[model samples]
Target chain A: MTQRQALSQSTGGTARGPALALDAGLLCILLVATPMTGSLTLLGETLRSALLFLRELSDWMTKKKLLAGSLAHYEFGVEKLAQAWTLAIALAMIIAGLWIAGLALDLIVTGESQTTSGGLALAAVTLALVTLRSGLQMLPFAQPKPRAFRFASLLVMQSMITLAALADDPSIALLADSFGAAFVALLMTAAGARLFSTAAVDLVDHPLNRKSEAYIAELLLEAGVEEEELLDLRTRRSGRDIFVELTINPSRAGSFEEARQRMGQLRRALAEQRDDLDVAIRLRAPGADSG
Target chain B: MPGPTRDQKSKEAAVLYTSLADLAVVTILFFFAVFTSSLTLLSEAIRVALMLLVEFYGLFVLRALHRDRLRRFRFGIGKVEQMCNLAIGAALLFSGFWVAHSVVAALLSVQAASTPLGLAAAAVISAVNLLINLLGWLAMAAAARDGDSAIYRAQLRARAVKLAASAIVQIAITIAALAKDPVVATLFDGIGAAFVAGVMVTIGFKMVAECLPDLLDHPLPGETKKEIEAALLSAGIAGEELLRLRTRCSGSLPQVELTLAPAGCASVTDYCRRVTAVENHLKDHLGGADVSVVVDARKPAET
Candidate 1:
């Protein structure tokens, strides 16, 4: 196997197994609670949880396939697939948000107030436990803190909504429940839209950020490759891997061997910067077509 | 980098106009679905909305290509196209599930009544949807005929599916309106929604299957591999001089990378010319491909 394949395997092994398990448990609780309470807020939360569960399940399955070497044939790696998956998740989130908002609006307009039930209480307890667990887990890992915080906030909001539904005053309860559903819907939509835009840019094959591009230029200069000799430089990212393709006119070099050595030095410099980079250098004959 | 050809620009315009038209029709259909409370119309609306999202995405890709925005991508934008198709397929799959669920729910509640006015409205909107979809389909077919673009072909296929689905929706809604028995009307509505779901699943599976191999960078077909070898031989590359050859397709563009042992050439310039010849021969043989040929100076025997 190639170095990339080995790297892919290592990346695959880091799949969030515990997080997936937690999501599955949350989904089960929401599934049971959604039908019993008939609260729009709970239903919206249920749908969101379901989508999150599916996303994690798909992520796990893709990583399993990666570890099994099923995707080893992909020369460019499976970063695009990961980006596509992110896009899918974003689309699903947006759809769920719209669906929830529509249902909440219907409830408000039709004056349909659902009664509180034991299921809602149980769901609230479950959310509290999950939120606490997620927050505690984030204490040890700084990288996942943002995601954990988001999850915790969503759960806290759901718990508060559930508590509102359990209020004795029917009129106030209905208002809080309906408004809470709307709030969750808006939150989901805004978050999904943000993720969608980011994933869309990646799917469009945008080049690396300006900082990375500048760094690459600095590296080339350090390797004794002049700006004028560089005919082309292209950089893109797929998943966790960075791909750099360069075309150089080596006419000024004393010999072809010396130019080849310079290319080798540039490759080493890039590799030292990032192990996940895949670099390809092409020597262009003077006056040759860059295409 | 070269800008998109006139042919490509024209194709992009066709896609953009049709997609905008589709969005309008689907939006009208969705409101009508709400007004009429027609299960069939709702299913159609949901399916078309998902499809239109994908159509607009394809159009965005085409415009980007025409504007030379993706010129820096070394392997071209084939992977991007495939990824877009894959997303469309997933959306279709989700639509199928939602429609199936709606069908089951409607069947379970057979007493659901439809007002005469609502039924009439549904029938009329379904007809309008069918007519617009038919026009869109024909336009896509004509556009696809002008070029061998994978995006256009995929768009054409999607249009055909939409046309068929609209026809199904029209027939089902018409029958439901005409039937006197409430049970029969509900049954027709359920069947219509079920059939549309089936169509979504079938096309979604095809799109996903077609994209996976290319997206996964599977090797070129045997025939194409043989053609590459023949082109290399025709370029006067000795069998032993060919150190490594790898071939894969990115979207519709074939990508070939070759590592050659520089044994026969006398100087670096001679070797460069030979490599260029090999690259040109392969590109010509493959019609148009991203071909990169390099000298493997590390080969012990060749060195």
Candidate 2:
């Protein structure tokens, strides 16, 4: 794909890579199956999941003894149930919108399976997907870009599946399925390749090590250590950890006892700042200042 | 004076050749993915494309700055590296979120379908990614011998994200094969994707966090601070009378400001001369020193 197309596809655009692949697979099934089997099978599959969800919900509620409670307790349970129910409703809406859009797109493209329910579903789903995608795309930052495209792909695939369910000609469904499969496969491969390319780039630098080293240097300076008094100042990284080595001026730092106390304080401060650093402070007295 | 030292020429060639090789490899990978016709493959290819864009931009900035190719940013373009680091983090975050969202959708829409072809494709992609990751590691090892380089770190982070994603895809494929129930298979797939996404997000956040302090002008290293104090003392300022020493790094350069007491009665010219001398000494010692020194009249005992 061109860079622009790839960008649009990666972000929230009409093209959804993985979802489109799924649509192709579903399209193949639709082409092979008659309308009676295609649409009805989809309906049956949807119903089966819905029933399974309800059964699980029922089991959970029974286990929790949701109904075996006083009026106040019952009220609290209802509040909790309402929150869950709201989420379930939203999920149902998105699925419904997707199913309708799929049916509508198939009808439009194939010039078949045009029914009143299909028409209404198409219009409603189209409007919903458009509004949702637009709204999501408007959100600040890159957070919503992938999500918006995901919604778009869902709409497209569902629309294709709906059309496949209603299509009278097996050939059209098969053709769409084949095309979709090829497209999806191509998209996935491209994505994998992108990942591979990124994998090839491994940075050799450790910026964190540098920063920590600088922080340590500042600590020593603030502790009354002369800059020139520090000898063999070295900092490096071993994996994720930073190692620091420096010599301090002890003679200028008052008594030997005081210098030791200052070193302790500096070490404590550094530890508090970064739990990952290994600092070694060597004290050089007046005569021992690398004469 | 020389046309270019042997080491300089070698570095120049390494940078140029590496960029070209990287572009060539990714371009070839993109084409290969196009022919493979796998969603998982394409998804990664898109990431690599975006990565190449960021990598090249970072390299371009780095090369220009190293070669003194940019007049506007003559001081340094360390911030460009920071910005690139930020971009890489943001990109990974975006990809992670994308993968998570897709996984969730798939989990919700679990269907009873066997995807042998998709599984095989994912396996192939995983193998290829692992191989590339291994190669990247070797390159990293070679680079590390020369001291920790920022460019290599960025590349490592990016490589890690892709490696994790590939490994997850491989796991998902295996799970799909073992799970008889399509729902179970879909669940495993979703979980694998989520795991990979989590890793990507975590690494991305870490990279961004690490770069922030550098960009924000964090204080100079402790050793550098000690060195600054030593430089001042050696320049005739006594350490006991030195009231305060403040130091920070701006870009790749050291910046220092100090307050000290002069030894004897000195004229304004004498003080300026001393400050200039200290500044010159710092520049020589610390390298690229931006120094500010003030002679305070009060001694340590008085203060």
Each model's DockQ score: 0.29, 0.02
User: lDDT tens digits, residues B1-303, model 2?
Assistant: 224444444444444555455566567667877787545555556666666677676666555545655433322345446656766776677677767877776656665444866655555755665666555555544444343246545765676566667667777867776677777776676677788889888888888777654444446666777877787778777877576665544345555656554554234334344555666677787766655553332323435
| TM-score attained by chain A of model 2 | 0.30
RMSD of each: 4.2, 19.7
The candidates' interface RMSDs, in order, read 3.4, 20.7
Candidate 2 docking quality: incorrect, acceptable, medium or high: incorrect
Error of 1 at A151 (Å): 5.2
Residue A179 miss distance in model 1 (angstroms): 4.3
Clashing pairs for model 1 are A79-A239
Candidates' chain B TM-scores in the order shown: 0.85, 0.68
Residue B247's lDDT in candidate 2: 55
A155 in model 1: Cα distance from truth in Å? Answer: 6.0
For model 1, the local distance difference test gives 0.73
